[model samples]
Target: MTISANLALAYPEIILAVGALALLVLGAFMPKQTSLVATGGVAVLLAAAVASATQPFGVAFGGGLIADAAATFAKVAIYVASAVAIPLGQPWFERRGVKTFEFPVLILLSALGMGMMASSGDLISLYVGVELSSLALYVLAAMHRDNAKASEAGLKYFVLGALSSGLLLYGASLVYGFAGSTLYADIAKAAGAEANTGLLFGLIFVICGLAFKVSAAPFHMWTPDVYEGAPTPVVAFFAAAPKLAAMMLFARVLADGFTDAVAQWQQVLVALALISVAVGAFGGLVQKNLKRLWAYSSIANIGYAVLGLASGTSEGVQAMLVFMILYMVDVTGFFACLAALSRQGKAMETIDDMAGLVKERRGLALAMTVFSLSALGLPPFSGFWAKYVVFKAAIDAGLWGPAVIGLVGSVVAAFYYLRLIKVMWFDGSAGATDKPPMEAKAIGLTAAVFAFPVVLVAITWLNPLAARAAQALGLA
Candidate 1:
């Protein structure tokens, strides 16, 4: 199909791309009016999200892009997560005297990239989307230019991101050579014809590259450093939105392009899940930095989410979607609460900084408790439902070993999460004293509001959404 003919199918992404450019120009001219930029950014994200939900679904750009139910769902989630991050980050930016119009523009562009990634149906477009998102993220990581740690984080991310891109690109080329086309449909057909060693190698490379993007174990070396060094709000954004996008793309690529090679990729995913859970469960036990601890937690969650993907079935995809949604809501709320806590007008970095938090702020304490319990996958919480779905999917797929390993990892990870709760509620340090609360009242309230849906998701509305997503993938 002609590009113009397919344009309507890509309107949501087009809107994001165009809006990002306009916002960039506007920010350049109105550099001091950060609030205006943030408002415009949120508006653009909301509009694009609505567009994604309402737009017609089909192939576009000669089958390079797909506006399917799954893509639309993921885009909406990314948009909402990015919108939430802006306001959550604004207070910290203002306090640090680094609040700028450019920040939100970068977020818009990042969301645009993620949307593109989710919708991509061709190897070329996938690479483009990855670069677009990674470039913006690298810049955002260094937004606090004066902070040495931020600069280091940005540099490390850029270098490693570039390496991953190279690996992905090389794999794409190999696949194209063997499959005789870059389109997923063509690749699937070619891969099904016979077991091609070149194709398997290419798939491995692609999986490795994607694993790096998701911070799955053995490729997660950069996650802790980046999360620790980046600004808290940026870390919050990193923890949720980009992950949803990457995982969406990962699952799509596997299901659409490598369906015939499920046996191979499923094993890879299984290994990744096992190692990630181990690393995540044990890695945080020694970390004092709150953000770094969450980084490890993120790896573990990604491991669990991948369990569904490893099942190589539509129901598996549904389970993965449920996990992603639960993770996004809970992590977003948790980080918001984290960002709300400060010491002497500065954001707290370590778990110790939260000492006596229960005594100081009951609301924040309770919110944190709920989020922590949810993260631990305790009963009646949204997270428990998420885990249950994936584990059931794994068992249904007959991946008993992985399910048991995952459960054990969950148990091990719970210690740190529970420990944090204990410290928050029962423990105190010498530095614990009554200081004026930081400018996080709005953030704390926002976290609380977001937490309710998460707490009641299973009982109320999450199933319908997951069902819709499954229907989108034709799994229902």
Candidate 2:
């Protein structure tokens, strides 16, 4: 189809691309100010993305590209989260006297890459799409090059990211060599008892590589260092949007490209899921830094999402989508609470620093409590239902052990989260007296953004989310 003919279904990404370029130019002339000034650009782009989301699904370029519901939801998450993360970082950039223009541009580029990956139908296309996103993030993680922690994060992310990309490329080449095509549709068409063993090996390598991006354990060494070292605001971005993109791509690869190989991958996912949950549950217990604890929490959370993926059914994929959405909300809320805890001109990082926080900021403390509970998958709140949906999918698929273990991991995770809560509310620190002079309205706004889905899941019509997931998976 002609590009113009295909335009409406892709309005969100086109707007993002155009906005990235415009910002590159516009920001150079504009003075450095608060992050909220960039709100206009973010809003325009987010609106475009949301607008495209409700469009009809279609194939473009002979299945080399797709425009569909799954891509739409991914774009929605990316735009909305970017809108939040950008403002949160603005104050840092303005204070440092650095150019903030390129920052939004990079996010736009990353979002574009994510949008492409969401719709890619072939391995070559998917790899290119993923690398585009990764390249942007590598620069973003390092943007604050003078900060030792930021530098370290950039270096670590670059080194590990390169390795993962190499592995993924090699696997893609092997898959292409064996199957003579990289398109997921073609791969699905070709699979059967006579499916080439090389294809299977390539598949394993691809999964291993993708796991690193999502920070699933065994391949997760870089996560804590990167999260702790990068600016807390940057870490917030890392934890939120990119994950939704990676998880969506992972789902596409499994459901669309390799549905025939579900049995092979199901075992692999189960193993990763178990290790992630165990390591996350234990590792988080000893973490002193809030970001690191959340990093470990992210690992365990990915495990729960993976458990849903391993179900290898339409319902399974929908549950995974819900998990990603809910996880995004919980993390964003937690980050907002973190940002809100700055006292004496320092953003709080260590758990001990949070003592008497409830005394200082009652509303933020309550928000943190809600977010912590959500992260632990506790009841009545939105996170509980996120876990419930996934666990139910697992049980339905006869994956009883993973489902039951998932429950145990959730309980184990609660221990550390509660530890932080206790510090905020009960274990008052000796000198925890400082508070931000200015309110973090962007932080609160983002927290509200994150909170909506939680309420949506708890109230009427989860079917909308489920239907979106099914459409994204192209179940029709």
- Kindly list the per-residue Cα lDDT of model 2 for residues 1-476, writing each as its tens digit: 78776776567667877777777666766746324337656776677666756667787766777777777767777778877777777666555556566777787788788888877888977897899989988888888877788888899999999999998888888778877888888776665447678888988898988898899988889999998888766777888888888888898987887878888888999898888999899999999999999999999999999888888888888888888877887887677667656666666889888887778777777778888887887776678888988999899999998899989988988999999888889975546555542435347544644464447644355447555665567332
lDDT of each: 0.85, 0.79
Model 2 residue 306 distance off true place after TM-score fit, in angstroms: 0.5
Tens digits of per-residue lDDT, candidate 1, 258-345, equal 8888888999999999999999999988889889999999999999999888988888888898899888877887777777776666
lDDT of 1: 0.85
How much is the lDDT of residue 149 in candidate 1? 95
Record all residue pairs in model 2 with backbone atoms less than 3 Å apart, i.e. clashing. Answer: 70-472
- Estimate the TM-score of every prediction: 0.96, 0.94
Q: How far is candidate 1 from the true structure (C-alpha RMSD, Å)?
A: 1.9
